[model samples]
Target: MTNLKLHIDYPHDIPIDAFQWTPETTLEPFHTHTSLEIGCCISGSGVFYFEQKCYTVRPGDIFIVNQTELHIAQSDEVDPSTFIFINFDPSILLLEDEKLLLPYSYQSEKFQNHIPAETSLACQLQPRIMTIHEELSQQDVGYLSRARSILIDISVLLLRNYIGSISSEQWRRMNHSYRELRQMLEFVHRHFGSNIQLADVAQTVGWSQARTSRLFREYTGKSLRDYLAQLRLSEVKKRLVTTDDLIANICFDCGFQSMASFYRAFHANTGTSPKEYREMNGLSEDFEKLGDANEKSK
Candidate 1:
């Protein structure tokens, strides 16, 4: 039996993005902006897809997903799942004078060292995550400044403790595969809403169509076409939640050829029609509340 479920809602207004997700099955296909995201699993077991590897995550486990990684969360066992995600653009913490105080820069190769595994620093850094969340939720005047300070502290701790010790050989092996896969992923994100073919993606990544397809499947455990479709569907859902666009307009914007196809894909992926999903997830009320809150906060 398949118990696939999906939900898409923006839960916070602060630019230091945060959200809580509880999924009975798998999260919908989605990508984030150029921001660093760290997630901790509060309960249940699952695999997090990122950087061409699927890392098995359990309760108390924390993982980092670097900027621009295409990712999804799926529960492996038939149990409820819950997690908290904290995301922030690196610029939030890096002032000109304080640039050195911030941890590894994403622009440099150093940021890539923190993917998929729990480094010694990540272990030490895990406990403070709760404190950061609490400060953000308080949403006081100086909370953003406090959060930024905590974030940079965490990054410095991770770099000094874990990233500083990697050998050159190990770094090369990791970088080789990660660099290629990242190139392919960038292509997928750019062309997912168009009439993209596997050959087209292969050409963009400098691989043969067959080899590229095999590599993508091996890395992600899903066909490239299926991944692209899901990406498109996710965009459609986001638009439905955040805007008052017509269904037909959203369909075309998300690369669906017709309304029937759009409806079928939407229902199949999300277990509800687009309209139903939006209403059930509190799109109208939540958006209004969020806007008012933002205005007040400002």
Candidate 2:
């Protein structure tokens, strides 16, 4: 029942991945993974939602998403954008002090989720990001080594110029809450698809159920039930696009007990039926396969 969205399996060899996206891409749900993500808006425009904040993203905009933060991006349909995302494990790089960089740091007031293109920091990182993307795309002879070198440079840039420091008093005050919240998140991530309740999460984190409810809302701005539902719905959406499983099967596999419930939740989240969503995303091959599976099940 572990939610796949929260737990990521980094590759053993490189521990880095590069992604290119175009206008035709659909938006993924608000989710988190363990890898630190760095991205650049290569062309056009979009909006990036990080935690509860929204930032307008255009060409040259470089952003970072830490492992624990929930985020998503949507392209403007009229002037659709292209983006390049680089995700890497910090353990892959040699560092004097990894925590100074926001993405690698777990506790710091200076941690940043993104930088706008207008900022000087973004200006400095843009060319390096472009070079990384080029190296990844063309995959020249020493591309992997070159990419890692660039990543170290980017880390140094953030640590020296961009990241902020917090006083000891502030860190002590925030660290406990942050640790508890992260523990709760990890619990929910591992058991969201099961019959997990507030009491379970509360007990796991050694907080009262009422306090757990209040703190989760304060931290994430969503109720526990609502957040769990979002996780389930996100999984369903992923299967709808990538799997040939029947709708009913997917519904159950994603932890929805009934087809009606899954349908209602999916529509509420995406403003479209699951079938319609699959078709619109050019996943009709899987959609048709799902139909075949459904017929066989019937």
Candidate 3:
């Protein structure tokens, strides 16, 4: 089975997405998703549910749900809550500030999910979230970069606000874990489009499979299987736009042996059929044919 998390339909090449959410919004309930999510409550009231606790969300409240946590939300029937949510892969932070990974790597039980209304941190984050929403909606030139920049700013605020909670030893451990994870990711990328098992990854990092699996989730916010599937999905997309190979061929070349499984995984992650995704991001069929004809004339 394809180990895909809920909210698999993140954009190609863009690692972040911001959108409006209401009580009526559809989502897989209590799934441990692969993206770090930060949400700002805009209006009404709601409760965010975790296995052990519930947080009542109100306007100006900022909630952080780390990628590994199983969580869900619902609003009061009388006045449904509305929110602006920004969900992103943690890998995006590596380019800007790898240390920003600190906030999301928090211990779930000790961490405070809800930043209450009156906190200046909440006030600080709301505008940045709004700016991200605008950049995403408008999609102006450099919007992708701009939105990521804003997200980094938000991360900084969160780090500053939560600094007291993280101990010096934990900070040291995070840096060390990041180094180990970097090695593991590089190994996986080198062997992408091949069958990679937990044992394979464990050997690369010189750790037991159990240790590798646990730390991989802590460091990357994804299981080994899901991470590999995502890598294959990314490669499939690159081939889709850059090459005109048959979809089945491209998929099989990427180690997706089953067409049905590959198609389902592609559509689930990209929110488009493979052909549609190609058409949207690459040259049209007529253009391709015209280029081919030009080539023939030569």
Question: For each candidate, what TM-score against the reference?
Answer: 0.49, 0.51, 0.67
lDDT order of candidates, top first: 3, 2, 1
TM-score, candidate number 1: 0.49
| Structure candidate 2, residue pairs in collision | none
Best by lDDT: 3
**Tens digit per residue, CA lDDT, model 1, 135-236:** 778877577667767777776665565445556665566556556666777777777777788988888768999899887764443578776777788788
Rank by TM-score, highest first.
Answer: 3, 2, 1
Candidate 2: worst 10 consecutive residues by lDDT?
Answer: 94-103
Screening candidate 3 with a backbone cut-off below 3 angstroms (N, C-alpha, C), the clashing residue pairs are none
Candidate 2 Cα deviation (angstroms), residue 213: 27
Worst 10 residues of 1 by lDDT: 1-10
Alpha-carbon RMSD of each model: 11.7, 13.1, 6.4
lDDT of 3: 0.82
Q: Candidate 1 at residue 201, lDDT? A: 83
lDDT by residue (tens digit), candidate 2, 123-171? 8888888787788778776787888888888888876664345556655
What C-alpha lDDT does candidate 2 achieve relative to the native structure? 0.71
